[model samples]
Target chain A: MNEIKIFSPATVANVSCGFDVMGFCLDSVGDEMVIRKTEKKGIHITHIEGFNLPYETDKNVSGVSALAMYNDLDLDFGFEIEIYKKIKPGSGIGSSAASAVGSVFGMNELLGRPYSKRQLTEFAIKGEALASKCEHADNLAPAMFGGFALVKSVSPLEILEIPSPKELYATIIHPQIEIKTSESRALLPKEVKLEDAITQWANFGSLIHGLHTNNYEIIGKSLKDVIVEPHRSKLIPYFDAVTKAAINAGALGSGISGSGPSIFSLSQGEETAINVKEAIEKTYSKAGIEYDMHVSKINTKGIKILN
Target chain B: MNEIKIFSPATVANVSCGFDVMGFCLDSVGDEMVIRKTEKKGIHITHIEGFNLPYETDKNVSGVSALAMYNDLDLDFGFEIEIYKKIKPGSGIGSSAASAVGSVFGMNELLGRPYSKRQLTEFAIKGEALASKCEHADNLAPAMFGGFALVKSVSPLEILEIPSPKELYATIIHPQIEIKTSESRALLPKEVKLEDAITQWANFGSLIHGLHTNNYEIIGKSLKDVIVEPHRSKLIPYFDAVTKAAINAGALGSGISGSGPSIFSLSQGEETAINVKEAIEKTYSKAGIEYDMHVSKINTKGIKILN
Candidate 1:
């Protein structure tokens, strides 16, 4: 192989009510990958763009994914990789997933598509596990399947790709403040009582119904996170205010996207998307916090090859 | 109005993870209601079969629903109602819902159909509130809409008739040890930790996904309840054993049906249904408890006016 070209999209993990067990990848933007064949049959990472970070392939996200691919399959193919990063490292927009998935996707192209998409995802998740510090597949799934997904159980292991709903818009607000996923998770209690759990299921069920039947109102009403959001919400300034504004601005639903500092809102159309984006920005402004927000449709396509 | 006939079907509430907020009515097999015009505007009840009781209308389940209709409309129509109680009470098969919905359906026919099905459901839920002492539409929605239903929010009062999934069969096991709905409510905890609640939502979402996509494995895996099932299950003897046996018997999913004494298992076909029934009965027999079981489909039609 002489040259390999690949691209991976940013993913949204733990989409509201799905908690640790769900994710979806977007098509609008993510990290870029450029892999070139080398004389040596080992992975080498050369360039990283868009954020301050290290250049070592071992520490690089793309490098980690490439490493997992090399380690899993006893193959020697020397490749120099360059990463043009758009999504940040810890923005909760699937930074780790982007890198890991990028490497696997790039390698698949270089190896003349030896592994299937599922196989690439498996290796990508391994890289993600090391970087995200959790044995989760929410980000990995969307990176692989490219749409709404559900992780039924982790131990018995099931990942389902739900069809991308019609009239789906993604509105995200990334506050400049940093809240690590580890800290967000640490705040959650070890055990929960029985009553609240029932409500959670009810909400979850309604959300799924909303997705299937295109009942946006039900989805909006049912988007509640009893697990991570309540405790970790304190870490993010004006979390409630931003969500309230999004809902008020006619967003179908809004909640903490992965481990905030980033909040994502779903809207029914472009009009609502813009409205929600403005609402979120205004709310953050009121709270005296600088943030980045984007209003875009749900990415029907996950990753693409650009040669 | 003279010689009016109305019908309401038996309903399945709780739907695995949706404890108190989901329900739908069955078709063909339910309660029958017949109303006749009398000389005076006074109400009289007769022919309460299956349960040994006197025929005073107020104490009757049909009478409760009738009362709501009569009160809500402010109408003066002397009526005689004969209720054919097909679904047995305290069976955890939504017997009360059948009667309640029957009342609304019968009265609507007598009044020349003044109310919509949703309106009748609202009236019917009031009757359920009287019977179950819980403010929920779990049984009523099913009684009105059939198939799968969602009680969107219990407080602000929303009941949604969602899609009834195809290729889904319900296996209900009715153990003849009476535990009232109030008693089940008393057993459950008032509050739950945030995290467990979120898992419930994830399971719930997966359950809906399974229903939407016709994926049985996901439904089975997502049938877990972290809240009410753990605590309230203690009240039902052999609850754990029956659940284990049902799963082992190739049922896709198993859980206590509503506020049981009754356990419900979900499967894709007749073979799984038969196996679940055998497994459940075996457990109950070992526990020395008398019980009955049924393998039924998700009844799509809500209710019908049987001539």
Candidate 2:
């Protein structure tokens, strides 16, 4: 149980209507890691890239997570870790989850891989709560296990794997704008009508059923979020145009990704994915917002050991 | 269109954690009706059995539904319906839905059955709302269409068909106690923490996935309702005993049946179903509540034509 090279995928939490409980992994959107053994008795923050991440253990999300696991497990092993942070931060794409999960995964191997992926995800949430001020594993679960994941319970941290169906493509559009979690969260209303609440639950119920049964048409109809999107879509530039454009381009459905500034459109085929990306970028261009596009398949394997 | 006969089966809404969106049919637990052509050009209801039900057009859930379709569609024929109410009222099962959907289904046949099952369920909701004051087709969806169903969105009324799933048996326990829908609904809280809300969604998501992938274990694991169960369980005399008894009797999972005075247990086989029924009855006996039991396979068909 010495040095280990592993990978943790980036996740899109809230996958349209799944807010806080549903998430899926991306093959093309994630982070990579390399872990090496040292004679020293503790973890060392070796490297970081692709984002201006801090190295001062406290400011380094990945570093702090590795430290937490080491302390919590009471292990006296030495390791140096290098992280390749490919996904951008503050883009509503679960950047913090990538770092925390990546650290836990790499370190778990250095400690004999005693914990399972589910265990690693649990341990990772402890670090995320410190960074996010609330214990949220919506992103972390998918990042650890890949595919479609659900957090059955939180206090004890129950993670359940959702069966992923084929022929699904995800198109992501990063508007190159920053929307902090705090600001994004503030836009939601505290109280909702009982009617709205029931509606949300009903739609959410169908969305889960669709994902479980691989009923794509149902999934398309169910990917609507009334609670947050109405309020938060205002924060993203050309949110409406981007959504309309994605649908026009053959997307089964489109909605704000996670907290948002980053928008995602889901389609049924590869061609639809390509069309959605093109449409999204075009919408952003029309709205005068700079954007980057990525077309990907749903990654079923979340974290993997990369030699 | 010529006169015809249509049947809508009884349904079980809220398959444990699904609440307002997930529902399924119980073939052995349902009702039946027969609609025949008449020269009278109006609506008439008769032949309700097993318990007292309203016969007046406005007061009858089923009768009102038949009238709604007759008025809305402006059909040229009259219908004489004989409802064989097999499932008892106040059983926490979709008793009222059986009537509502049953009427729509029968009338649809008389009008050449132009409306799809989804459309029929929508018409049924018009009747359900008149009785329950909420526009929910959770029960009707499963009733109109066989197997497990979800009413994804109700405005245009989107329906998603989920698998009824094998390796599962339903054991329903009727305590011979009545809990009105309005009284049962009064127990819920106005608001819940985001964390609890997330758990509800998670379990729901897992249940959907379980049904799709035919993962019974995950379905059992996901059988939880944080929002309604906590508040409603207090009304049941031996709530914990019934569930514990059922689980101890080889049941995979168990929970309250919609606005329950009745409890339902999910078991793996015939043996477990028998055991679960005994356990539920025993628990009720210990609590001094009168009861009866029905052990059944998940019914896909709604009401049927006895003739």
Candidate 3:
């Protein structure tokens, strides 16, 4: 094929108790990229839309990820990419990861699908590293592979797709504010009490068990983040109020989406998801903060080909 | 019924990466308890065998656990318990947990099974606290519930059972030595580097996923214990050599069993379990350390009723 267009879903990383190990994809919010095969031997971004992201081939996530894939394949042809970003930048909902994953995913399809999903994830991670300074696959893994993913190890690039319940829904709220990734990360303590670490891992293990077993009560109980949330929630406005309201409204679990400004919750059905969204809206309205909310089922199809 | 007899399986707590939250039960090694109904209002231990344990109701785990159950039920009739301890004390293979779990389990049956498994576990933890001076349900949960269990929260007593593969086997080598739980626990650092803690939680998450998905390779990769094993392994003789030998013998994963003088390895089949046992025997033989080895399938039945 001469050209390809792909839709890469936004991802929720950390998942509270899981910290850096767990994440899941959302169906409604994401970034779209169109890639066209070109005669030239180098990648280029021909156009950009929506969010004002860097368009430089080396600087942009899409461009860098596409370039990484091209170099890995030693391709004879290059690609011209067009970006249409729907997910907001610095929204703590994996905006950069969608761009990075969508670029390599679309490029690989146009290049005869030369790489496996895990291999493509490696390229996407290179793009993610450009934005965050440290490499992490929590967002990119779910973005490429769809559904809930566990980043078992980064050195060998081991990623496992966890089976989630069919009726699981996601409610996400993006408050009109920005939290710098580096600044949010800097708020965390360098050392953690061993007792807290045990509790965190126990919750993480329970969360995984809940996903596999489809136990909503266990999932709700396991969603607590005693380590990172207690420290980072101070930076987000109305964090406690919003979370408490969502839980009261029947959301299975609620927490900051990635860093801060955006918060999300998981529920069993669309009604509960909508209820959670209304709860979040009510909470934010009381605080007089403008927000954008989306309620959707978990995106089982991570990156999709759009003609 | 005049009395009820039960067999409570031995357990391996911590399970490498899981520390205070994870454990599994074994079929071949355990403790047997017999509980007879009595008209007295207070529980008592009438007899003991195979181990030099206290017969006083308050001091003995079996008697203490039976007492907890009686008090919880507010029952007029009491129980007279006899303990048959087959699992060696202080071998780091959850010897005390078996007794604690077996006592409550048998007492519950004699009392017409009024308590749920979780409720019974609560009584067992009371017994465990009498020995360790702290309440922990890691071993007791698995001993009472069967197979692999994760103690998500100790306060409200949340335990989740993880699915295990049908052919999973455990190879345990118990060296004839004693390591006090308090002494082993004292070796751990109160604070852990956040980086190591993250790695640990990642491994723990991966291990749970592996168990639920029946992915052996993932289990092998995630069985590493970076937190407690490093400190506790120093107390066990031939810990490193035995572990290395078991891994080399085609075992999927190997590590110290609990705060161990006993080391265990997980494998997929009988052949690998046997091979691991032979390898451990060879290692201990060279070191001239007396050891007892048991190779068996994962215990699907935690506590069994015996006529």
Best by TM-score: 3
Find the candidate with the highest DockQ and give its number: 3
Query: Which order, best to worst by lDDT?
Result: 3, 2, 1
Cα error, candidate 1, residue A134 (Å) = 1.6
Number of the top-ranking candidate, with lDDT as the measure: 3
Separate clash counts for every candidate: 10, 8, 0
TM-score order, best first, reads: 3, 1, 2
Off by over 4 Å in 2: A1-7, A56-59, A68-77, A107-114, A188-191, A286-290, A305-307, B1-9, B54-59, B71-77, B104-115, B185-192
Interface RMSD of each: 2.7, 2.7, 0.7
Tell me the docking grade of candidate 1: medium
Q: Could you give candidate 1's per-residue lDDT for residues B30-111 as a string of tens digits?
A: 7777878676675678666666644776776667777777777665556788877777788777888888778778777777
Better of 1 and 3 by lDDT: 3
| TM match of model 2 to true structure | 0.88
lDDT (Cα, 0-100) at B215 in candidate 2: 76
Candidate with more favorable, higher lDDT: 1 or 2: 2
TM-score of each: 0.91, 0.88, 0.98
